[model samples]
Every structure is written in C-alpha cells, then in structure tokens.
Target: MSEGLEESHQLFGRVAEEYDAARPRYPEALYVALEEQSGMRLAGARVVDVGAGTGISTRGLLDRGARVAAVDRSDRMLSRLRARTACGALLADGNDLPFRDGAADLVTYAQSWHWLDPALSVAEAVRVTGPEGAVAAWWNTVDAGKADWLAAYQVRLAESCSGYVGPALPGWSMPPIAGVMAAAGLAVRETWIGWTRSVRLDDFLTDLRSRSYVARLNGHEVEELVNRERAEIGRVFADGRLTVPMRVYLATGRKSRPGGG
Candidate 1:
C-alpha cells in the first residue's frame, strides 16, 4: 500500500470508537438491492467483506445468515468488530487477500471501497468469488434534505474530508468500481436506493466525526468543527432531534466465467 492510504487506515484505527458511534449502517433496503441484483440469497453464501471496518457491513451480512469472513488491516477496528458480531474477522489488507480462489459466493465492500488499492483489490475479489457468484459494493452519501439542518451540515462535511484521507488512503475521490470489476473479469450491473433516517442533532454530529476527514483533525480543529456543527444544530432543532436524509448506491456484477472476460 502507498503511504497515504496506509496512513488513512491507521487514522481510522485510532478513531475506532468514534467510528462505531457515528457511521450509519446500510438500511435494509441495501440488502434488498444486493439480493435483487445478485440473485443469490445470503442464508448459505460465504460472504467476504473487504475493508470490513468495525464490521458494520459484516453484521449486515450476518443478519442475512451469511457465513462471513471480514478482512481489515486494523486490529483495533477488528477487535470492536469481534465484540459486536459473530462473523470471522481477519487482520489483513485488501490488496493481498487471504481466501482461496472461488472461496466465496458473495464478496462485498460496503462503504469502505474508497480506502482500497482498486486494481489489486479488484483482482483479489475476482479470485475469491466463485465463477457464478457476485461481487457487490456499496456506499452511503449524505442526503440533501428532510432536515434543513443536515443540508447545512453537508457543507461542513465537504470541508472536513475535502483532500483528507484515512490510513488506507483517501478512499476514492472517484471510485472506479465498475471499471475495476470489469478489469477483474466481471460484467457490470448496479442498483440505487434512497431513504431517510431520524437522528438527534448530537447523533448527526457524531456521524460527522466518524468520517476520516474529521477524524484526522487536531484537538483544536476538531473542537471547533464540532462546536460549529452544534451551533447549526441548535438553530434548527429545539428538541435536539432531527430527521436526516440519505442516499445509498449499490453496484454488483457476476464473476467472469473462466472462458469469458
């Protein structure tokens, strides 16, 4: 891994607690999207979650009855994962995966795709997913509405993460997922899902701190950012709770058959 990406991964490790508190899990709608696109049920599939930080994604698979093996480079994050979910957690890097060829029926990278060395990760994913299985990737970006305050918060989020990166790296500025899947010998396909979540202003602020961008801040900057966000929240909500919106995108593809690209 390159220095920047490696650095970003380490940053996430240091902030695992904040991460667990702040990051939002994929809505059940996400599972439906993957299930629909892959045409594979999770009950008996061997699912591999690459960059499975804190097992937020891994748990999603576990809930669906997947036999999950979650791989992450950070032991700190994986430890939290172990305590929270029954899925198998491996301390490993995405670039050099450990599973055997055709070992998995479904391989997923949920919200963590940006932290990977795409070219190598794609090759690794291809090698692990069985010939007729699927590779599904997902991410959650801030919703623009349902709360006047959250839209304002998005501005701050953009500032915090704007050139910021995590230990594995800055994740992808523009994720080359479909292309990577293609290069890895998969035919590309995708689905989109959108929804809103209700959260307190404090919870929303906690969510921001979970991002690598804000997580990398120094004491003063971090305080200032949180205070600024709180001020905005104060203006918008009297009871301290607010409804925030979200958009989720899921992309999936079948592993290339041996004789085809």
Candidate 2:
C-alpha cells in the first residue's frame, strides 16, 4: 500500500507467533471512545477491520458484538485472526479495499495505518464505508514509565536494538495525526489512556525482530542487536518478567453524510 509494506508484512510473518504473544490489546477506555463517537454501534454491526494483526483489536470489537471482516496483507497475521473464535478473514490492503461502497457500517485500522500512506488510505476508507459510517485508527505505544526498570529497558530497545526502534516508537515519532482523517471527508477526534502487560524477554525480543527495520538488517547484526537488548532486559528484569506500560491513542472519524463529500 505505502512505503516498504511488502517487507514489513514478510517481517511480521516471520514472527507472527511472537507478535501475537507480546503485543498488548487496546485499553477499554479507548474502546469506550470508539463506541461513543465512531458513528457505528459496536454490537451486531458490520465492521471491516483493516490490518487486524493477530486479531488483537478484532477481538475487542468482536466482544462488543461487531461482526468483523478482518483484513491484512500478512497471511500469518490473518491466519492468527482465523484461528480465533470470531472473525471472517480477508487478505487485503488499506489503499485498495475489496469491499464495495457503503458496504460496512464501520471501517477500522488499528496499529497498522503508518505502514500505509495516509492520504490514499483515507480516500479508500471513505469510498467503501457507508455515508453514516465511521473510520477509526489507533496505535498502542509503550508508555515506558509504569516502572523504572521497564523504562530503562525500552531505552535500550529503542537505542541499541536494530529492529525495534521504529516499530516500538512510531507512536512517538509520527507526524501530525489530528488532520490526517480530515482528508477523507471525516471529522476527527483522539484520546489516550495507559495500559500494561507482563511479557517474557525472549518473546519481546522476537517481536522486536519481527519489525521491518529489523528484518532489513543482516542476520548476524540483527541477532547481535537483539542480544544486547536481551542482556539489558536481564539487568533490568531479573525476575524473567516485566510490566510493560503502554498508551493507547484512539482516533475516530465519521464518513461524510450523503452528498456531503
């Protein structure tokens, strides 16, 4: 769709298992914002979940009773969603959605929109969503302050690890997001809340290695970089587990009403 997505998808494929294990789900407060402002009801409504990686966000929406068509370029990610209890999987991209105009009540992209070009994706999202529909995108950022040790570990991961920098910190580094949704003729709003998860060092490092930036590295170099991260993890989290702090940023926008766009 945009940027080095094929490579990113391949990288995700390589560590789908670890990605599933380490990635945290969206916070409930963010979901509450979606339910209130997204213009689509969560229960029993049809939703198209773009880049439904590991079914993480899909599961949340499903729990709200939304019937989700989980779509992603990564077969491994889609496979993960397929194995889940609820989800209809589709292999697709955000720039060229397969669904027809006005097909879905909600169109959502979670934690994967930056891998795509925003202008093109917003247009495509508007094209496929119903006039009354809404577009929602969210990213989970490592909060890095729930505990002292975890914050130090994140610094090591971002500074010393080869693959984890961009993926781990895109939430921190992306350009202005407030008006990105406005391009698609949708009004935008955003909110943030913190979350935490307990994860093993190896699983976390594998997930880091699954990033496109990491996969771009030579094998030995990638291993070496992650090894440094692992050593830091050991120094910081000698107990074999760490409570990872995360911040969920929820962005919601609604499709232009009939004849409005």
Candidate 3:
C-alpha cells in the first residue's frame, strides 16, 4: 500500500469500534447475486475474506453456512472482528496470503479491494482458490443521484472534505476490475444491486464520521463537519430518520476447470 493508504488503514484501526457500529452491512441480495454469478454454493464453502473489517461481510458469509477466515492487516480491526464472529481472524495483507494453493473455495474483498494493488492481489486470490473457485470484490456506495438530499450531501462533502471525490470518497476512482481479472485468466462478471436503509439522523452522521476521509480529519475539523451536517440533514429529516439510498457494486471472477469449461 502507498503511504497515504497505509495511514488510512491505521486510522480505521484506531476507530474500529465506531466503524463497526456505523458502517452499513451488505444486503442479502448481494450474497444471492454472488452465488449466481460465481456458480458456487455458500453452504460449507471455505472462504477467505480479505480486508474483513469488523466482520461485516464475514458475519453475512457465516450466516449462509460458509466457513470463513477473516483476514486483515489491522490488528485492532481484526480484534473487533474476532470478538463479534466465530470466524478465524488473520493479520495479513491481500497481496500475500498465507494460505497454500487451492486452500479456499472463494476469496473475497468487501469494500476493501481499493486498498489493495489489484495486479498483485488478483494473482494471489487466483492462486489461493481451488479449481473452479472464485474471487469476488464488492463495495457499498451511496447512490447520490437517487435522492435530492443525498445529492446535496455529496456537494457539501466535496466542498468541505478535502478527501472527497464524487461518490467513491477517499478513493478517487473505481478500480479496473475486469481488466485485471481477465489478465489473471479468470472469467469476470459485474453486478450492481440497489438497496435502501432507514437510519436515525444521528446514526447516519456517525457513519459519515467513520469514513476514512472524515476520520482522518483533525478533531476540530471533524466536529465542525459533523455539526454542519447535523443542521443540514436535520432540515431534511425532521423526524430524525433518514432513508439512505445505496448501491452495491460487485465483481465476481471465477476460475475455469481443467477442461476450461
């Protein structure tokens, strides 16, 4: 990871509790989509969840009967994940997994792929999974275009947060997932699933504060931003409840069997 990216990971570790509480969980539809796209059943599948922060995705996988191993470079984040889930937590990076070849049925990155170098991480994921195994990477992002209030929030974020860039915040752009996976000899497919969540205004604000971009700000700056957001969002959500529009971007890359089927 680059210096800035490494620093952001450490910041996430420092606020692991807040992140676990505030970050949104992936919708169940996402897992169904993963199963359909990867042609892999979740029941009893061995999964390596790379960048498994706070066990959000890891827990989802476990609920579906997958035996998952949560891997992350942040010890604090892993500690929180371990406390919350039954999965084994490993302190490791995505580019270099400790597992032997074909050890896992699937390798997944949940909202954490951006932190990895795709060229190296993609290769590692392919190497770690068995024949016909798959690799999946996904992110849950705000669909600002779906709601006027969300659009305005994005504008405010761009104006106030130095790290903000469109809806992908923190990261300036989406990764070239298809190209990298194709280069690694995997068949890749992309899926976008739209979902919504209703949250209290305070909880929504807390989620914003937990974002790497906002969390990296100094205390005064973060407080100022949160205060402004409270007033602005309060005007829109008089009942103190917010309906957050979200979209899940998922890319599944499946390995071919020996016969290339």
Candidate 4:
C-alpha cells in the first residue's frame, strides 16, 4: 500500500471504540439484496469478512447464521470486534488473507473496501473464495448533501482535514465497483438499500469524530471542528436530534472458474 493509504488504514485504530459505537449498521434490506444478487444465502454460509473493522459487518453476518471469520489490519479494531462476539478473528490485510483456496462460501467487505487497493484486494478475494462463491462489497454512505446543514458540515470537514475525500456528495456516487470485480473475473450485480437513523446531537458529533479522515486530525483540530459543527447542528435540529439517512450499496459477484467459466 502507498504511504498515505497505509497511514489512513492505521488511523482508524485511534478511535476504534468510537467508530464501533457511531457507525451505522447495514439494514436487513441490504442482506436480502445480497442474497438475491449473489445467489448465496446467509444462513449456513461460511463467510470471511475482510476488513471487518470493529465487527459491525461480522456481527451482522453472524446474526444471520453465517459462520464469520473476521479479518482486519488493526489489532485494536479486532479487539473491539472480539469483545462483542466469539467468532474467529484474524489480524490480516484485505490484500493478503490467510485463508486457503476455496475455503470460503462468501467474502464480504463492508464499508472497508475503500481503504484497500481494489485490484489486489479483489484478486485476493477470488483466491480465497470457492468456485462460484459470492464476493460482496458494500458501504454505508451518509447522504450528507441532502440537507443544507450537512452540506455545510462537509465543507468544514474538507477544510479541516486535508484527506477528506468523500463518498461523493450530492448523489453519494459509489466507487467504480464493476471494473474492479471484472478485473478479478467476477460477474457482479449492484444493489442499493436506503435506511435512516435518528441520533442525538452528542452521538452524531461522535460519528463525525469517528470518520477516518477526521480521526487523522490532531486532537486540537478535532475539538475545534466538533465545536463548530455542533453549533451548525444545533441550528438545524432545534430539538437536538435529527434523522440521518444513509444509502447502502452492495456489489455482489460470483468467483469465476479457472478456465473462464
């Protein structure tokens, strides 16, 4: 990985606890769409969740009856994951998994794929997944530009954090998923699931702090950004709470055979 990306990957460890608490969970509809798009049921599946973070995606897969092996590069993040579930945990990078050939029924990256080198990670995903097995990558992207307050907050984030490249505001456009999956010789189906969460002002502020880009800032910068954002949020949500909508985009594909099936 490049130095910037490596640094970015390690940044989440600083706030793993806050991230686990504030990050949004994938909705049931997303799981349903994954099943439909990948032709793989979560029940009785052996899933390897790459870059599982603090087990947000791992716990969700486990709850749906899939035996999940959670893998991430951050030990602190994995520690938080282990605290929540007894599922197998490995400190590994998405580009280099420890699993053997065809050992996994499904491989998933939830809100973690952006941190990886897509081509290498997808290749590793194919190497570990069984023939015709499903590889699913999804992200919970905030619809930040939908509201004026949120849009202004994004501006503040960009100004405060130099590395604040986003999930594409306004429409929340997804990354180039089809191209990367195709490079891995997989046929992909894309699906989108929309959901909303109502959070108090404090929790919402914490969510901002948990962002990888925001977490990379110095402590003083984070404090100043949060204070400014809090004032803007107060103006937007008079009752000190508001509903934040998110769109979960799932790109699920099947691993191709060696001879090009």
Best by lDDT: 3
Sequence-dependent TM-score of model 4: 0.92
* Runs of candidate 4 exceeding 4 Å displacement: 1-6, 167-172, 256-261
- Stretch of 10 with least lDDT, candidate 2: 161-170
lDDT of 1 by residue, 1-261 (tens): 353544757888888888888678889989987887777888889999998988899998999889999999888999989987987789988888898999999889888776788788887887888878888888886555445555556655666655443222333233669878876667777766788777877877777676677776777887888898788777878788876677787888786443454
Give the Å error, residue 237, model 4. 1.0
Residue 83 deviation, candidate 4, in Å?
A: 0.6
Error of 1 at 219 (Å): 1.0
Q: Order of candidates by TM-score, top first?
A: 3, 4, 1, 2
State the lDDT of candidate 3 residue by residue for 5-46, as single tens digits. 546469788778888888899999999999998889999999
Provide the lDDT at 46 for model 2.
88
- Poorly placed runs, candidate 2 (over 4 Å): 1-6, 145-151, 161-172, 175-177, 256-261
Is 1 or 3 the stronger prediction by lDDT? 3
User: Lowest summed-lDDT stretch of 10 residues in model 4?
Assistant: 1-10
lDDT of each: 0.78, 0.76, 0.88, 0.83
Q: Clashes in model 2: which pairs?
A: 143-245
Error of 2 at 45 (Å): 1.7
* Best-performing candidate as measured by TM-score: 3
The digit string of per-residue lDDT tens for model 4 on 189-239 reads 887788887889989888888987788778999998899888988988999
